[model samples]
Target chain A: MASVARKNLFEDIPRFLVAQAGIMFAVSLVTIQTGILNGFSRSTSALIDDSEVDIWVSAEEMVNLQLTLPIPAATVSEIHAMDGVEQAEAFISRTTTWRSPTGDIAPVQMIGFDPASRMFRMGQLTEGAIANLQEPYTVIPDRANLGALGLDEVGQSASINSLPVTITGFTRGTQSIASSAYVFASLRTANAYLNSGLTTTSNCQLEGDRLTCSNMFERDASDIALDPPRALRGSDGITFVMVKAQPGQDLNVLSRRIEAEFDGMVAHTQTELSTLTRNYWVGSTGIGFVLGLGAGVGVVVGVVIVSQILYASVVDHMKEFGTLKAMGASDWMIYRIIIEQALWMAILGYIPSIALCGGLGWWTFATQGITILITPGTAVVVLGITVGMCVVSALFAIQKVTHVDPAIVFKA
Target chain B: MVVSSLQSPVTYPIHSLPAPAASSSYPVEHQPRRAAIAADHLNMVFRSGGGSYPALSDVQLRVPSGIVQLLMGPSGSGKTTLLSILAGILTPTDGAVHLLGEDITQMSRRELARFRLENIGFIFQGFNLFPALTAAENVELALKTKGVSRRFARKEALDLLEQVGLADKAKQLPKNLSGGQKQRVAIARALASDPPLIMADEPTAALDSHSGHAVIDLLCRLAKERDRTVLMVTHDPRIIDVADRVLYLEDGKLTQTPQS
Candidate 1:
């Protein structure tokens, strides 16, 4: 029975596909948008997700990684002294201008980490090596921003906030949703450039028990003729502190302890920070709502298309169904025939739609450098929605079939 | 000899009727057949915006087992309506129908469908073979509905097609077959269930005289050989001579016509 019904459904291939085209378009729209949304949500917190740390200490009112305020450098020392804390490092993320070789200044989000602690790992390098960042005034820029940053090669020279710097390497997969190019630099280089009037020598030396440094220089007669020299300040403030717990230590316990011990800082596990960052972009911002609305519209459009097509097929086959009824077929039997046709349509329509969505995802990634993740789990979920759409359409067809008068077969 | 006249229609409740006696009009070997179809005071009326109209009125019928019965009537004479009522496809406005000894009028739609599947086989005028299915599949579908296994039903469907002299064309779709071949396939489907009663509405109307005569001859032989009751509606006088009994209906009134 199923085979016969399927043959009947596909008797006119052109007509059948035309009927299913609307459904396919709608499904593809939903699938592609969902893939993009998944990629966007993951990329929003890619940094926090990829950080090799167990706990993160941030300013008290910090909401997300992008909008974090500065926290005093003293938090790192306090967290390192607590129990279950094997190591802690101050991580600085600041947005500054990059002067390209062609004299184009582009805003870049610079990530500064202690290379010796290895608290953060640079993304896959397309050129050069991450170890070269140990040299002062060296940085690794993401390959995605190579055009925007206007650097030709690894040995190209550039300046960060008017400070001389060399592009030592290129990284991949470090693109952010904020559309700002990301660059990796050592802790010392970033502090010197980000905090103006801070001499490299005074930035290194620390005062007793506190991170305070000052510059003392005798005024020369020639310097007095020009602008007076300003006092040097130390780079002692950080946006966050990345902490690694000792072996067998629970991050949740350590986070709670750090929060209790500190007054002006808050501690969160890696997973918590990742979720907070994603939620800030997906919920507080309207991107998630807009994508969700698109998906909902896709579903509605799919339902309407499938229902109309199934209903039309039922109408076309009314006489045949009437004959079946006269041949002693029950209402249930007729329902089965119609439902089987619907299932076939759904399964067949989904094949091309999924393929189309996958191709679109690949093309978008290749051309625009935007990640669109079409995972296996996404396919299964979309398949369920497709089948559900067909089943709902079948229900409408069944209503028309159940009321068919078998006696109509007797008419001339 | 004719048992009843055309003007005075015979009416009897199935439960009260006695077992039929041997009739000289029928063969000696086929005597004393049981009643396969019985109706009492069957009436069907169509009420429309114009006014109430009667399709069948005060009709009572009994078709004996193992004989071919032909119902002939002019247009708008309610031959098809009466057949529909007898086949349990439609409920009479007033009257009771007992098919194969069951009161089909009292049965629900689902029960009637089951009863029809088990006892009655129908052949339609248009040949009504599912266009997508091959000749053999058309017959196998009925058997499957009767709970036969697919493999066994396939074998049996082919055998029935062979019985109807279309074994070579078993795999051909309906559109590829001639009108006579399509009708033969329909006959095979009707016999797939081994039904005790076979009902056909204008089964040969769409075929030529040659094909029409061949199909009627096949139905007559199946009825006589298998002891199954065959009832059909037709306007063709050429096939009337093949029936054991011929009933005439005019304006929903039925009368028995003696065979010459």
Candidate 2:
């Protein structure tokens, strides 16, 4: 059977290669699209996945990390006091404007965490230390976006929401799928930038028996502080309270406890949070559907092209097959021969396709800084799909062969 | 004269046959000739969109083992149909065909395929060699289909090709071979399985007189040397002298013609 398949493919090299080209193009398309989408989904949740905390406490109804609303930083203390809780620290993420060295404004996702607590660690750094973030007005920017953020060197200074900050270090591979540059800073520095212009005021308006106090108002130099607001201020109102479970404590149990005990807040384990965030970006934005549709189209095109090619080959070899049948070759033997041909095509087509796709992935990443991951698992899965595609196509050709009458060989 | 159609189990008298030719390689007393193929009331009807056409009606045949039997008929005379029925390649609409003493018409398709693989060798008019395979490889494939090991099949294929005087062209593909050489390769393939019964349909139809006579001579010699039953269909009168018996058909009826 192997000899037969090899001979047939070699006999018409041009036609065989044309068939291989169709399969290869389809496979490469599918691999590239799926690889990029997978890379994007992973990047969307990289921050949460890379964090050191075991559980995340965010405002209720927070769909994704990027859209999280600020929760009262006081929640950290409450979470710290709960049973099975080891430690809790305030974590903040705000998409704020950065004033680049060129004085151009660009959006940066500012991540602020406690420098003293090990609840969250900075991303992979190419330069400087994580302790440097403790310095006042200091930050670490992703190296991939140095040009976009206009931070030429480690000591270069920039501004986040008009607050001057020095680029004390650089992080690598922290670029988000949103194309927003990431800046890491201390909790205090982020709070100063986040709550710069807003002040608390007790301007009460009365109507009927209800009295409403409007404390949020813009501050001006002429206005005097009438009284301090009752609620905590500044860094006390942070985006999230990241918590770690004590040794021997179950994260799911701790998360459920926090969710049940706290009001106006939700608790999720690290994996849950990452999945939720990834799903929000992928499912809510319809990116999953679009990418899936692309892969589906590739598979369908591959099936059609391979089926047509195989069918044509079977037609051309109809006399040969009929001769084999008349020569006492069983139906199973003929079927095996055709299936072997299909398997050969799949393997031969996939080898070059994976190589080409790997090159394309590298080129795309090097040029655009958009990661396209072609992992070993991805290769295995793509190969499986390729084999399946060819086998299914061969079935159509097998049907044609099975119906051929061996007696036809006797005809003129 | 019209021969009576076989409607019942009737015995055929073996003693009525003439003495074996002196040139026969096998002596008559040493071999007990048995019927290699027998058809009883074989009827074949082809159905189509418009109506059904009867190709063979109430036809019967018997070819003795260890002899070269030739079947002669005009075009559309149902010779190929009868050969296909006897080879278990097709089942008649009614009646039974016994090849090598088993009722092949009663066998399932899968069973019939296996039966034919082990018992019959077929040579087609078109020579139907796989275009991509070399001449020896084509013959080797038939041997492999009969459960011969790869190495042994290759050796046997070469030997069979040598028997048919095609050993020199063993490495050449069918496309590189001439029409007569292709037919010889087909003959080698048929003999590869070493089946007890051999069937050929118009084996010399596409060849010139010299090639046709050569092919017929090879078929006759190979059959007589091995004492294997050979049934061939031919329209050429030039090869009729080589047959041990000649069966003639007209309008699907069979009559045994005395050899000149």
Candidate 3:
């Protein structure tokens, strides 16, 4: 009977509490581990996923979004001329050291975009002040990272590659999994960091209306050319050409067209680029496997703890259960009684598990600017796993209960 | 050896046991017209890695309805083993057991379980109640096991508890009740299913003489009134006057005539 299981579990309040505590610990381990994995995967592709661009065309010399050889800003011109190309912008990202006004340096990823296109959503971050980036040599840095970057306020100045850049506005807090602080600036400011815009003739100049390299990052400068030939015709350090297709245009088709026309460049639909970014972080690193192992350990710990509790309960009332068997209770009836107790443990532990996840999510985001994603779907999965583990453990314990001799009741 | 134990059609000497004073409506001779439980050439051997042990040897027994049969034997003589075989909790190593005219020993354990639920009630030496459950709830467990509806189970369990003179103890858990009250609850649970046969093993062992006599007297009265066959395994000799017949076993073999 349901009452039997209920009474058995509750007969000793201290024991029941201890059992539930173990279950809560186990479920929380699983929930938090998977939540972090989800957060890391999302952060890997956060920028790409958030962008409005339909296609991302990277230089043939590009390794990934974080490490890349800049293409000619002229690539944007070419895409703008293509059929069904609604808009195009030069999006550049590169790692550089930032020197705060206090002269402290930190590794930072500077993302440069054409202010006119505003495709990277500079306006939303600035409360419709995309024009702030229009200010010369101005940048937007996440507020969470400002203190670490040695700048404290919007008007403070910082140096990237020894070139002074002012912070005109602040973006919402964000953290890059690569351990780099994200900073948004205009293309001109990006050129300054590249040392390409140091002098009018230092890197590239406008040939008619197009910015082209007069001379690139060294035909022979060890720092400039990753591959010499690529450095020669280089777009002066523009990393990517972000394109938005016209309404009803097929993104796959447009990306294919771009790949066909460009030399040494990879054209990827938005979704493909997002997947590529996520895969690189999740598969190319050990983090995914490590998190999965943490979750698995949680399950094993849960099984052991629950099995011990149920088995201990069975032992405590060996005579009583034998009496039931002699009274003609079937094996199924005995098993159901234990399983019901397990179900109760699962149901009781689930709420606290998600509650712990929610609190951890908030703390992580607040301190590190990294989101720990815990969706309702994730909650449901945790509940299922918790219940499954408890039931399996109960069954393992009942094996011993059913095999026991019913005649033991008489002996007692 | 079997014939030496059961020398006649009657397994035990029925002439010795006094007529059950409680069963005045039916004399001892008037009973035994139909056997409520019958076992033929039963043997139970337990084999372990070390050796084999003969717990019951060439045992044959018959208990008629509406009477009490007391199984008396020394320790290790297999009195409990015989009771288990007849109740279908165990399959005898040889031969068959019939309860209420159905051959139970031939049935699978699953089938035997269902048959036991339908035809037999069991009481243990210890008042083996779930420590967490109240007295009435313990009785309700057997009623529910017999497929009684929840609506009727609670009411019937209370009625049985009252019949066992434990109306005031219905809501108390087993630990809170005295030994006598706990045994009364066990009896109530046994009668919850209203089976034709009631089997108890050392039902009075844990009680004092006063409570023990009172408990067994109440049990036999409740059972005889319902026309249920009462079979018990016990060593105490003071209960002879209350039993309709007595069977004795020695060295796993029933004696043709009890030494007492």
Interface RMSD of each: 1.7, 1.8, 1.6
TM-score of every candidate: 0.87, 0.84, 0.86
Best by lDDT: 2
Candidate 2 lDDT, tens digit per residue, B1-260? Answer: 11122122112344433444443322222223566877777789999998998988777666677777788988888899888888888888987788888888888888888888888888878898888899999988898899999989988998999999989999999989988899889888888767888999999898998898888788777876777888998877777777776777666767664222
Candidate 2 stretches with Cα past 4 Å from truth are: A74-88, A99-105, A114-122, A126-138, A143-159, A164-170, A197-235, A244-247, A253-264, B1-32, B47-54, B255-260
Which window of ten consecutive residues has the lowest lDDT sum in model 3 chain A? A223-232
Please give the DockQ score of every candidate, comma-separated.
Answer: 0.49, 0.49, 0.54
State residue A47's C-alpha deviation in candidate 2, in Å: 1.4
Expressed as tens digits, the lDDT of each residue in A50-166 for candidate 2 is 888899999996878878777887788888999999898888888889998889999998888877777686668889998887787788988778878987799998777666778
Highest DockQ: which candidate? 3
Ranking, DockQ, top scorer first: 3, 1, 2
Per-residue alpha-carbon lDDT of candidate 3 for residues B1-260, written as tens digits (9 for 90 to 100)? 01121112333323433343341212233332467777767788999998999988776666776677788887788898888888888788987788877889778888888888888888888888998999989999889888899889999998999999989888898989989899999999989878889999998889898889988889888886887888999988766667776778777777645654
Off by over 4 Å in 1: A99-106, A116-119, A147-159, A196-235, B1-31, B258-260
Location of the lowest summed lDDT over 10 successive residues in candidate 1 chain B: B22-31
TM-score of chain B of 1: 0.87
| Worst lDDT 10-window in candidate 2 chain A | A222-231
